[model samples]
Target: MRPRADAVLSEWFGPSDGRLLAVPMSLRGKVVGVLLALEGGPGLNVAMVQQLTYTVGLMLETLASRPNVPTPALTPPEVISGEPEVAVEAPPAVPEEAPRAVEEVSVAAVEAPPAVGDGSETVQLKMPIAPAPPAAVGRAPEDERKHEEARRFARLLVSEIRLYNEQAVQTGKLTRNIYSHLKEDIDRSREMYEQRVSAEVRADSNYFHDEMVRILADGDADALGV
Candidate 1:
């Protein structure tokens, strides 16, 4: 056998008796390496060449997809260039003071003499001190009832204001610039409500505030057609 330039990879592998097959190992249509197969029993055919080419291509593609290759992260590399970190120390605990001695309480029991003659020992009973009544007990029930009703009304007023404001905002008539003016109007409305309705409906300061918010919201909604 002689080395021939006309043959496939002749000079690289030297002269051989059997037929040689050179298949390209590729990934994504790019050639990565070459697969060399020497046919021992039979001559190389089209079916054998196709099978070998497909198997080698799949292996190369799998290897390329694996995490074996080292890749740079897309994010900016972190810099260790900064001031040296200082270790934080916890605060020292305070020493506890010595406990004071407790004074002993004395309880006296007295026995009373039997009044005529059956002769049974009678014991004198001592009554315990009663606790003082709560602060609410000092307030009249009628006033408390009125205050509760006022609080409930105030909460209702708040709900109404929220609904009206939502509608006003949707209509685009309410702007941030006139918020202070609206607030002033609300305050005026609350003062008027308090002066006129104080006798009819007993309420707290919060009740007047809620009423003011409601009045402003209603006025804005009416102007906006919302």
Candidate 2:
């Protein structure tokens, strides 16, 4: 069949077989949408078309203007059935048993034993004892790290003091006046090392002092005196 132009879509997808028409669906004065019609035969009259458009537009406007209402917490679905609902009896609830009372024995009762009737035969009783908890072996991870850091700092500081004042250290060691010979270096290194290491480490431990004794005095702790 030869193509013919339809009034509604004449520009695009034009020359359609079926006659198309578009009428505005208006609410009050503003147009909401178009009510389209594709007619193959005699189309709807003006009155019917007007009624249909007005109904659709009114519904759209009402929905748009209406305030939102909160949905029910439990909105059960509508169950459609032709047959009537049959009454079903629920199962009886099971009765629960009452809890038993726990008996508490006093310290005196536990310590004191029941006297034997004859005292002729001796009976040995075994007591159930709970296993002891595991002992804590070593320092925690953080404490160990802190300790390691302190030791490193002490070692470095002591090494530096001995490094720069090698002559003084040697002379002091021989003369037994090590403290006097390397007093300045020793004091400065001690101060800096103590400052770097925390007071917690210093409270019980003398990592820096130990390092000075070990390194500066060549394992002769008394040589460095201070």
Candidate 3:
């Protein structure tokens, strides 16, 4: 019988003084690769170990999905006997020659720009400009306001639903009536937000399409594409 893989890895790294961690690279219950990390300093915590293991597992899964370099498999002696063999030959040698001399040029002897307007007119020189760094995408005031509004709306809806549900329960209705009503209202609010966001996205997409068409009609395709 074959020994367990985890037991094998445990034995391999157990004797070493340095800290060792191994994460199995698996996808859909199939092992694809393995990630090994060794630390010489202080030991790692449980949370850090778990996080590193999960990250390495994800990386391995991603790598396994991509194209990789192909390697040839080894053949047995009986299979190799049927293949043809080629002899290796070394290339002929060549003699070395002396290097040629090169002439040096001086910057002071180079021609300068001609004088403008008999040295009376002054011309301004432009300096080289560097590119600006990209702006960060962060939560804006409008987004915060929207989030607050959404939360307020959700709380109000929850309270109203709960009140109606309590009244129904007091009148001798179902026992879990309050929970059911609250769940329904919460689900409804989530669905409503999803629909609103989808509609806004579609509107923005349509506006972009119209703007592109107008720009193309005005013969400014280069700026539009850029």
For each candidate in turn, the TM-score is 0.24, 0.39, 0.21
Best by TM-score: 2
Model 2 ranges off by over 4 Å: 1-137
Question: lDDT tens string, model 1, 1-226?
Answer: 1123235446665665555444444333344444555556566453344333443333333333333433433453344555785444544544444333222111112122332322222323221111222345556787665554554444333333333343343343454323343444444544554554466444333555433333333433344222
Each prediction's RMSD to truth: 45.7, 42.0, 34.3
Rate residue 127 of model 2 by lDDT.
18
Clashing pairs in 1: none
Comparison by lDDT, 2 against 3, better one = 2
Query: TM-score order of candidates, best first?
Result: 2, 1, 3
Better of 1 and 3 by lDDT: 1
Which regions of candidate 1 fall more than 4 Å away from where they truly are?
Answer: 1-137, 167-181, 188-192, 195-205, 210-226
> Candidate 3's residue-wise lDDT over 1-226, tens digit each?
0112236544755544444443443444444444455554576343343334333443333333344444444433332243475444444333344333221111111111332232121112111111222242585766544443443333333333333443432232234232243455545744654454444344323322232222111223332222
**Global lDDT of model 1:** 0.40
> Considering TM-score, which of the candidate structures 1 and 2 is the better prediction for this target?
2
Write the residue-wise lDDT of candidate 2 on 1-226 in tens digits. Answer: 1124334355554675554344554333344445555545575343344334433433343334334554434434455655686545545544454333322111110111232232212112111121222342586877766675665566556656655666788888888678898778878888887778788878856777777776667677778755
Clashing pairs in 2: none
